[model samples]
Target: MVAPDERIGPAQTGALRLRLSLFYAGFFAFLGVQQPFWPVWLASHGLGATEIGVILALSIGIKMFSAPLAAHGADRSGQRRRSILVLVAGSLAAFCLFALTNGFWPILLISVLFYALWPPVMSLTESLTIMAVQRASLDYGRTRLWGSTSFIVVALLSGQVLVWLPPSAILWLSLACVAATAAACLFLPDIRTERSPLHRGLPIVQALRIRALSLSLAACGLIQGSHAVYYAFGTLHWQAKGYSENVIGVLWAEGVLAEIVLFAYGGRVTRHLGSVGLITLAGIAAVVRWLGTGLTDSLAAVVVLQALHAFSFGAAHLGAMACIGETVPASLSATAQSLYSGLVWGAGLGLMLLASGWLYHGLGGSAYLAMAAVALAGTFVALRLSALTPRLPQP
Candidate 1:
C-alpha cells in the first residue's frame, strides 16, 4: 500500500489532522461534562450511592458486547466513519431521553441505549486515527491532545457553572457537547486500510490467539479499570470532605492537564520506553496514585497524586495504542480497538464499578486501596507480558 502523502499533498494531510483534532475536541468536551458530573445529576434525582453505581456499571458492561459488535460491522463494511456518525447520532437521541426520565429503572434503560452507541465511537475513531497515522504520517498524541485540551477547558467552565447552577444543568451542557460531536463527525476522513487475506474465522477469535496482544490488553484493562471508583465517586468523595464544585473541577482538569503534557511528547516517550515500558510505568504510577488518593483527602497530597494521571492514564493509553499498532494487522484494527475498549474499559471497568460500590459504601475513600491492589496485579501481568513478547513486530 502506498502512503497517502504520495497521492495527497501536505495540505490534505494537515486537513486530516485538523478534522481529527476538532472531532476529539468535541467528543471529549462531552466526556468532560459527563465524567465529572453525571453522578451529580443522578444524585439530584434521589438515587442512592449503590443505585448510581449500578447504573454506571451496567452502562459500561453492556459495551462488552455492544462495542465489539459495532466495530465488527464497521470493519466488514469498510465504512468506519459512516458507522461512527450513525452511533453518535443515535447517542444524541438516547441522551435526550434523560430529560424525560427520573427514576433508576427509566434512566438505566436509557443509559444502556446511549452507551451502546457511545463508547464504540472512541474505538472506531481510534481505528481511523491510527490508520491516518500509518498512511499520512500524522502524530497520534498531538492529534489526541486536542481532546484533553477541550476536556480541561470544558471541565473548568462546568465547575464554575455548577457553583451557580443546579446539578440539572449538567444534562443540558452534556447534550450540547454531544450535538457538537455529532456535527464534527460529518467531517472525519474516511481512511481505509487493506486487510490481510490470510485472516480467517472470527476476528475476535483470531485476535485472542495472539498471546502478546491478549496479555497486554488484559494488563492494560486491569490498570485502566482500576479507575472505576474515582470515575464514579471521586467528586462525591471530595464534596463530602468539604471541597466545592470549583475545586473538584480544578482537580479533574488538573489530571487531564497532566495527561495533555504526556500526550504532547508521546512520540518521544514511546520511542524511549516502548509499549511494554509505558504499561509498566502506568501500573507503577497507578499503585502510588490510588494509594495516595485513598490514604489522604488533603488537597496538597491529592494534587500531587493527580499529577500521576500522566503515567497512570496517558502512558497506559499510549502503550495500548502502540501495542495495537505493532501487534495487530491492518484488517483486524477495528476489531482489536473495539476489544480494547469493550473488554478492558467495558467489562473490566464494569466489574470494578460494582465492587467499588460495596467498597465505598463500607470503607469510603479507603476503597481506593482495592483499586491499588488491582493495579498492582496488572503490573505483574505487564511484567509477564514483557517477558513473553520481548519485541512484537508490525504486520
Candidate 2:
C-alpha cells in the first residue's frame, strides 16, 4: 500500500503536477480525435456498418489479452514508465502500418497490433498519477482535468479541420496527437513505490470471487458498452437526420465538456456520495439517457440526453476507478486496472458493439431501446454492488 500521506495532499505539488498534467492532456487529445472520427474514416474507406463494428470490436477485444500481458511485464520488471514508453512506441509503429495500406486484412492485422499496444498506457498512466499524488501531495482531479480540457479542444478543432480537409486527414491528426503524447511521456518523473516481496499478483480467481467487483464489472460493462450503439452509430444517425458535421462536433464536445466538469468535482462527489451510490446514480442516468435517445428525434431532446453523459459515463467511471484504486494492492494495481479495462471496457464493450451493429441494421433507431434495457440491468448490478461491498475510507 502507498503510505497514507502519499495518497492525499495539498493542491500544489510543484512541477511534477504540471508535467503529469501535460502528459495526460497530450494523450487524451489523441483519443479525442480518434474516438469520434475513426469510424467515419473507416466508412470512407468502404467498410460497411457490420465490418466497421467488427474492426472496432477486434481492436478493443485484443485489449482483453494484451492489457494483462503488458501489466505483467510492468509488474515483473518494476519499470512502469519504461513499459509504457515501449508500448506507445509499438502502437505508433502499428498505426503507421495502417497508414500504408487500405487492404482489409492488412488493416485488421494492424488494428489488433495497434490496440494491443494501446491499453496499458492509460492504466499505467493512472497508476503513475495515483503514485505521484500519494508521494507529492497533489490533487488527482486538478491534474487529470488537463486531459479532459485537451480532449475538448481537440474534439472542437478537429471538427473544423475535418470540414476543410478530407476524412483521410483524421489518420494524420491521430498520428500527430500520438507523437505529442510520446513527447509528453518523456517528461514524467520516475517514481517507484514500496514493493512487497509477498506480492501475490492479482489473484484473478480471488478477485472474481468477490461477487461485488465481478457483478459491478458486468453491470458497468453492459451499461457502458451499450453506448457502442451510440459510439458506432450516433454520428451517422445525426447525419442521417440532416445535422451538419459542425453540429455533430458540438454535440460531441458538449458530452465531453460535461465529463470534464464531473471529473473536476469527482473527489468531492466521491466523498459525499460514496462509490455505490454514485455508480447507482450513473446507471439510473444511463437508463434515462439511452431511452430518451431512442424515444426522441428532436435536436433539443437529443442534446439534453447527451448532457446526461456527465453521470452515465463520467460518474460511473469515477466510481469504478476509485473502487479499483482502493481495493487492489499497489503491486497488483496495474493488473487490476487492466482487468477492469480488458474484461469490462474491452470484452464486454466489444460484444455489445458487435450486437449493436446488427441491431442497427435490423431495427434502425429502435436499436437504442435494447441499449436502455442493458442500462437497466446494469442499475440492478450497481445497487447490488452497494449492498455487497464495504465502503473504503475517504481521503
Candidate 3:
C-alpha cells in the first residue's frame, strides 16, 4: 500500500481522523433524518408514488454531474474541506425554501436546489477521509462507523418524534444536523495537492480507462444502486401495510445497525478478502436480501433480511472504498471519489427510481424483485473485476 500523507506530521494525522469522523457523524445524522422519513413528509403533501419517484429520481440524477464537477474543483484546488463548507451552507439555504412551498412542483423545485448542493459534499469528504487513511494507516470503516451510529440514533429518535410531531418537523431537524456538519467541516484539515510531477501528469480519464477501476465502479454501481426502492418507498410501503412510523424507523435502524457493526469489523475482514472479494460477497448477499424482501411482508422475515445490510451495503461499500483508495492515486483522489458517488449512487439510483415508481405501484412488496435483478447483474460484474490484474502505484 502506498502511504501518501500530503506531508502532514504523524501527530496531525490522528486529529485528522477524529475531525473526519465527526464530519461523517454529523453529515449522516442529516441523512438519517432525510433518507427514512423525507418520503413520509412528501406523502404528507399528497404526492403519489409516481410523483415522489420523479422528485427522488431527479435528485439522484443531478448528483451524477454535480458531484464530479465539485470534486474536480476540490481536486484541482486541493481545498476539499472548503468546498464542502460552501456546499453545506448552500444546501441549508436551499432547504429553507421547502418551508415556503407545499405544492408538488414547488417543493420539487426546492429539492432540485437542495439535492444539487448537498449530494456532492459526501464524495468530496470521502476523498479527504481516504487520503488520511492512506497516509496515517487508519481504517476507513472505523471512521465511517460514526456516521452509522448517528444514523441509527436519528432514525430511532425521529421515528418516535414523528409520532408526536407533524412530518414538517423533519425540515427543522434536518437543518440542525447540517449546521452541525458545517461546524465539523471547519475543524477538518486544509491539505493542498502536492506539486509532484506524477500527480501533475495524471488526468481524470485515466482512472476511468483502467480496467480494474472501471469494473470496480460498475460492480459498486449495481450493488449500491440496488437500494433505490428501499430508499424511496420502504417507509411508505410499510405504512400502507399498517406498520407504525416508529416500527418503520426501527426497521430502517436495524439495517444500518447491521451496517454499523460491519464497518466496525470490516477492516480486518476486508484486508484478508481484498476489495474484490468483499464486493463479490456484497453482491451475492444483496441478491438474497432483496429476493427475500420482495417475497415477504412478514415483519420477522423483513427484519432478518435487513440484517444483510452488513453484506449488502456495508461490505459492498467497504470494498468499493478500498478499491478507490488503492487503485486511484492521490492526484485523482477526489475526482475518483466523485466518479464512484455519481455513477453508483447518482446514475444507478436515479435510473432505478424511475422504474421503482411504476413497479411499486403495480407490484407492491414485490417491487424489490427489480432490485434483486440489479444485484444479480452486479455479482457477474464483480466476477469480472476479480479477473483483472491489479495496477501498481506510479510515483
Question: In each prediction, how many residue pairs overlap at the backbone (N, C-alpha, C within less than 3 A)?
Answer: 0, 2, 0
In angstroms, give how far residue 304 of model 2 lies from its true place: 2.5
Two-way lDDT contest, 1 vs 3, winner:
1
- Cα lDDT tens digits, model 2, 37-74, are 99888888877877876887777888888888887766
lDDT of 1 by residue, 1-395 (tens): 23222344466789898999999999999988987789999999988998987886776788889888987877676668878989999999999999999888899888889988998998999988887766676778899999999988898789889999989999999999999999889999876655433447777787778787899899998999899899878998899889987788778878888999999998788878888999999999999999999999699999999999999999999999989888877677888999999888887887787788789999999999999999999999999999988765421
Candidate 3, position 55, lDDT: 84
Judge candidate 2 against the unseen true structure and give its global Cα lDDT, from 0 to 1: 0.78
Q: What is the RMSD, in Å, between candidate 3 and the native fold over all Cα?
A: 3.7
Per-candidate Cα RMSD to the true structure, in Å, reads: 3.1, 3.1, 3.7
lDDT of prediction 3: 0.82
CA lDDT, every prediction? 0.86, 0.78, 0.82
Q: Model 3: clashing residue pairs?
A: none
Better of 1 and 2 by lDDT: 1
Model 3 CA lDDT for position 77: 68
Off by over 4 Å in 3: 1-10, 40-51, 101-106, 195-203, 233-249, 295-302, 361-367, 390-395
- Where does candidate 1 have its weakest 10-residue lDDT segment? 1-10
lDDT of 3 by residue, 160-227 (tens): 79889988898888888988988898887765564224444444675687677799889988988888
